[model samples]
Target: MKQLLILCCLCFLSAATLAQATWIWYPGDYEIWLSNRMQNRRTDRGTFFPVFWKMDSHYPLMDFHKDVTLSEPEQVRIYAEGTYNVKLDGQPFEGTPTVITIPAGKHRINVKVFSQATVPAIYIQGNKIISDSSWLVTYEDKEWIDETGKTSDITATKWLHAGSWNFNDPAILPSAFTLPVKPMAAVKTENGLIDFGKETFGYVKLNGIKGKGKITLYYGESKEEAMSDKGAVNVDWLTFDKAVSQDSTLPASKAFRYVRMVTAGDIHIDNVSMLYEYADVNEPGSFRCSDDELNQIYDVAKYTFHLNTREFFIDGIKRDRWVWSGDAYQSYLMNYYLFFDKGTVLRTIYALRGKDPVTSHINTIMDYTFYWFLGVYDYYMYTGDRTFIKEIYPRMQPLMDYCLGRRDKDGLMEGQVGDWIFIDWADGLSKKGPLSFEQLLFCRSLETMSLCADIAGNQPDAEKYRLLAADLKAKLFRIYWNDQKQALVHSTVNDDVTRYANMFAIFFDYFNAQQKEAVKHTVLLNDSIQHITTPYMRFYELEALCAMHEQSYVLKEIKNYWGGMLRLGATTFWEEYDPHESGPAHYAMYGREFGKSLCHAWGASPIYLLGKYYLGVKPTAPGYATYVVEPALGGLQWMEGTVPTPAGNISLHVSTKEMKITTAGGNGILRFGSSTRPTCTTGTIQQTKDNWYELSLSPGSTYVINYQSVK
Candidate 1:
């Protein structure tokens, strides 16, 4: 009888342990709060530089609740980040009770918190009752009292499932969240100046310091940038008076490899070290090839991407570490093939969206707004997280509505006052009146909305969005498609064609075969049209080529462009690479000596290109339930890599004469072309075309194929 009782107790303990609690908040509230903290950290040479646009904050008051039925009476422990009140079954707990006993029955637990500085978050724990995303939270409770002190209706109040990540410990508060950091010594030091030897970001620590005066630390991504006290983007000035030696860590995290310290009075430092602050995300996807230079480029791209991926996907580690929607859009794509960190992607999306009364476009840029929609679309494509889509659907509507309301009389997007039409950083780029590129992105965004609406179960809205997308797509072709130019013009202002619209159209599959070919020749191949210098636009331009089976050409371009940056001693990729420029001029941008970011998120496009285009692994269905792997050597002798999906890693090894493919999970199709008929040892090959063949791939199976090289 005792053994039987112990067994029952063990079973109950296991069940209770399975129900773990995590810190929770109103969805996106913490993200907005954290982004404000991160974005405001930017400083330009000791001067605080914030975003030009208005910054939004979390709701000052929030109400969180959960409906639960307990089998036995239990005491629930509560922790909150702000001033709070607790209630059980519509009855208020005496006075913010830390532990409250609930009778054995059905009850609704509520925690209302108010905070102005940080997001109102809570963590609750009990044997059967725990706080998690399952709990619902809202900014407004809308519960009122009548004249007689009776509770009024709150039927109109909207609630959403709480947002949470890995924060499960009771002692750890969500508001006190920070990235992990590690201490590292400087590689070399000259007098007061210290160099870490590579571009890095984090808090600077001055060890064994005894000072009685002011010390100015100039931070720079490049050595030249660090040395130039006047030109450095971020600077930290410290005034200290200490009789005994002590260590002082900088208050704010800054990005720099070289730190030039200029001290006044009696300031002494024994040594210099830094705490490298970085996001805790694992790299599940990777790429390597036969070419050593290409391998080097890939490694550098990954590092550049990692450096930019922190609290959110910022544009760069240094100078303007603000989350730009357009730059983040590229980061999302690269993320799918590198870290596959969906949490970061969702966090970034939420941060960018903010709490919208629908004022201005995201990042105050027109194209950026569309890219935000596209980012959501890709997120769903890669992760098939319908709950996320449903949760964010309401937010999407307002943004889309904002875009729709801003359309010109011709029913196209035009740059209005305060709208930065940042298509690229190129000089003389037209932002005037009804841009075709904007219209194209608008159409894509609408299509994304349509797809998401269907997933979100808004049938009528889905159909409406579909019609809007179709109508806009038709208009895009009708207005911008230049038959003579054989490409969509940059803008219809004077019917001048550029590569942006035509390139995007090709990859988006908006064009028919003939039009795609024409655009490829007339716009993409034609150098007379304004060349896309920024790696940002080049990402799409090259993607268009890869989509059109121009991998061979695109490979050369990637090497020439990305490899050119490598030759210039770029430890990480640059924001923009202009091969024509020379010496320190290469480092200069925006009319400043060191304005260009040496490690921009968009510069890591090769990670996406090689993974998706060359390795040829992409989801044909959402969440990679079904995917396609069509490996292209792209002029390399051999290549092997893993592309991460929500399901698992889809690995590939390809050479001139043979190919091998394996997937951890998912239904996949292995497609390739060869001069001769291919033979697969593990699977049967079906000839899809004259020289093309396709093989069905099953999870946990390796398929090896031997074929004559077509190229």
Candidate 2:
């Protein structure tokens, strides 16, 4: 009777543990597998179009194990994909038993699975042990025996914490994972053309359709492209011999604002709608200002971000839905100020840095490789996930070593035969010689590695990378910084003073105060310098401007550029925007009729700019343990925003007459400039200069101060 009671208690405990059980696989295995599936889903002109780079798959066979201690015997239920075997204390279980009994005391459980079609994964639930990230997983293929016919020490075998993406349900296999979708009707349909009223991504839903012969739907980001055959970037075709009289949705999701439906023979169409598929990410960060135009820009930017944010942070919804490292880097920064979706950020990072033999740069772009490293740096700074840093460090070292080995005689990174020096999509852009931009990003990446190494407890490599970064930073200045030009020249061979390197240097803090001012005058604000037409590079250009306290000027530029797109009836932001171009010409890029992605992820820069620069809330310490909030009105009458942090949300409202702030949970220092002395009863105030004042704050404090804004 006592044993029965104990078993009942153990059963209850095991049920509780089962709630936490989730399917687990080797880290980065499922990510690479899912990314390959997503990247290859792209199609152009009714034909499949995939990424040029090599796609990696998950390991077919995997071994997962865990050692546990229990005060009493407990029952464990096991579930897994693929054929598998179980072992307890070196004794193999007969066949594959789903239910097993473990005796009291210490025991090690092991599950081996083989799945060629998808990632081999497992789930186990017991009183104290469950399949989760705590379990170690490996794909070690080698084994050796001693002279005594006993297995040798397996210490050399590589094992890592199993990866789990919150798949708590045992029935919902990771291989069958798909995003949620909902029905969406078109806003208008005129003359067989359907418009969703804004840029959207989903499968086209045919309602009440009885079709025969061929049916074609051309998708486009603009109205003109949907109506023209050669202009539309995506198309779907279907054929029916007899009227089926049923609702049918397209197989793949596509990006489109307008769709031109063409039918042949007995095909009949009642209405046009869609099943909109979207990522479910939270929007904890928000912004509202007196300027209506800027508010619209923020809303549209948010929508753009939502479209690009899927299982991974992709570049865009339309063309090239592939995860580009450079694009994902910008998305990560914007995410810090918006969704704060650390999981999505981590997934994108892992997918980009796949299982590495260190063959080539990420996305085959030199700058993109560095961007991936920088993404890791920012991820730690924002989320304070030290475990991820340590987990990814082994791969980081090899990737960085691959980069270090690719240097020229002077320890500079020059474009190699296979490397694509894709700084931006600009015409007449030179891609020869050792580019200053690559070196600048490379130096930043090295510094990131040093910081990550410290977090990962690699002291020797940390110092080595630190010194290497320092030497490279010094070399970059010596080789590229032309004192007369007051800007980092574009490349060693061309020596053109472009905005890419110079603007990046300012915000990177690689340049001094005098150098920042000089670059601002010569490159950033210089009219003679070739202008940056793409939103990709413009993100950095604007960030550099904002970093220099040029918020007022940057605000005007934002209005002139992003607001300019809004003025032209843009439902969502574009990959590239030029005031000089108009109508259908604005939609053209890469020598194609409609190659530009209208709703690009990088187009959502206002979210980052307004949150960090204008509202002026940023972390002084990692994970917002300490942060600084320096609100800049930037010619606005009023502005209020909430910046998401790992702890909580930091809310702020600013006007010429008053300022209000409520910290989420951090040591905050609020800095502002006043025309006159400001008075506050909420906190202690210190005057740093003639106009600037600083106020100290603690966690969860709501402070209201009466102040006059300084011009």
Candidate 3:
């Protein structure tokens, strides 16, 4: 009762906090927002304001400038003529005829431009101050806005200016571009400020108006030596030629915050602006789910295809965009399966929406070990939503057929062998690579696909796939199994060395019992070369052992691996072990250990598998119709966890003292846990260190199960 009371209060407080937050504005309400938008700068704390050039969906806005020069920093001040309350860092900034200051810094500003009682042209005079004479002429440019309200790109012409700073003036220039909607300017009108519906957005522009000509920027090896915060870097000694007419091209370094133009003489001018239809997206938010944050990540991952087209969402709220960086595909797939097995209804629907049939499926598989099949299998294990299964089977069938249909002449699936013989884990072993592993993975996915077809009542397809998979397995054994090694060779063509490949095949039951035991012995006790050791050294060792039911070894590896991660200052997993040089995201090393995250999804998979199998909490075999209650504790102090299964919520509280388990509050029967070893069939069970147990029970019924301890 006390816990429930506290939970209620916490929920209320969270709701209130989100409701009270508001957007803030900065530097008064002037045209400074235009400058900020182009540079992708944010101010007023972390609140994002719309770009001046790109207005909101409804309003049209635009701007162009004639004078361009880079000295300290100068601005064409915008005068607000109307009285309004705008935001500054989630706080309100109000009043009329406000002055906007533009400094040479990064800032994303937001300001409202009002209309006049009559038609008034709003213009701000360009300001320039040229203090240097030794600088040579560099390049010039022209700017424009795409007012069409759709996808548009603009370019600038590059040329050299020969005149001196004194000759460059704002009076004479090129054609004046029309604003997308209304423009903001200071003038005497009937109303103090013109009101133009809601606010619009766009960019500002600066043509190559020359002053002291173009200045070639120099830099040191490091940012510290380049220039100081006080602008104190001496470049007076470096000399270059005067400006000559050239194409306006942006270099990689200048792409971020600055644009440079040169002149043959000493003239320089600067302007950058454009109007765009944009919304405020930098609102501070994250995917926060109490029970399944990992699964939430997966739910978001399926929408990777949307990254190029649209922003993501959880529920209906939009989310930040995530790109596919190639290094993180493992994390993405694992998350997909985690959510799929947990039965997140919204996530399931979201998965349906992400289906692109060929491109997405192929991308998910070819790029990441054909790993998508496990998620599909898990989806069936969680929901038993036959309708959904049927819908997806056809879409995925073609691809599955392709993999199964393309076996070698010997009937073994033909493909490049992955780094080792193992399909799921990717690491190099002596003389082994990725092809054989990929073939194994292809074989595994086919078998699972056949089972799915059977469950969907597509028996003919199931039989066909099943027969094909069986034939492939037989040929694989005939071709790859080495009689001398008494284990599966790394490759039939190479026959070079043996490693995790044979063990993985045995773990997945791709071999018979005698063969499986022989391979297990070879990996765990027989082979010195493949023995599991350090967490980093044997990253996938525990999972492989678990697949082989080498409980003692699995337990040992788990303790060492998990403890090492915790000791490494990991709050979450990381892409690598060493905290030091993991790339731009340096802080990620402090999170979890998701090494290479593309293959293993690392820390996430370990946690999920431990929670599901070791904790004896799992989904029912027949989808959500029931629950599986068998958990493997692997000699932990104690285990307490809750998994959201299709039947309802399955809670697990295992007493290590007596090796007993207590399950409560779930629908269907606990099918897997017995007095022996727990192998989940339906409801729940207490898994022993080295035994097999199964359970059967109904929802809301209390079941107490005890197991004999091995130690």
Q: Compose the digit string of candidate 3's lDDT tens values, residues 1-711.
A: 999999999988754553121111111111122212222432211234332322211112211112333445554333222223333333334554244334564432333333222111122322431212211111122432232212233464321111111112223221121212322221221211111111112221223444444443322111222232222121111123325422222211110111122224554433322233232222111121122433333223222211111111111101111221121323322333333222223222223223223322232334232545655665566566665565456546766655545555655544443211223332354323334555566677778789878766677778987887787677667766787777776666576445555655754667787777776676446655444322222434555566554545665554445444444333333233433343334222223221122111233445444544555455545554655555555555455555555444555666543333334334444333234453333345543333444455665655555544443
TM-score of each: 0.95, 0.96, 0.47
Give candidate 3's error at residue 266 in angstroms: 25
Q: For residues 437-513, what per-residue lDDT tens digits would candidate 1 score against the true structure?
A: 89999999999999988887778889999999999999988888888778888787878888888888888999999
The lDDT ranking, best first, is 2, 1, 3
Model 3 global lDDT (CA atoms, 0 to 1): 0.38
Query: Which candidate ranks first by TM-score, i.e. highest?
Result: 2
Please list the residue runs of candidate 3 whose C-alpha ends up more than 4 Å from where it truly belongs after superposition: 1-361, 364-369, 404-406, 415-434, 455-457, 496-500, 524-527, 530-540, 547-552, 578-601, 624-627, 659-695, 705-708
**Candidate 1, position 572, lDDT:** 89
TM value for model 2: 0.96
Q: What lDDT score is found at residue 642 in candidate 1?
A: 91
User: Comparing candidate 2 with candidate 3, which one achieves the higher TM-score?
Assistant: 2
lDDT of 3 at 642: 54
lDDT of 2 by residue, 292-327 (tens): 989999999999999999999999898899999999
Candidate 1: stretches off by over 4 Å: 1-18, 141-155
The 10-residue segment with the lowest total lDDT in model 2 = 141-150
Off by over 4 Å in 2: 1-19, 141-155, 242-244
lDDT comparison, 2 vs 3, better candidate: 2
lDDT of each: 0.89, 0.90, 0.38
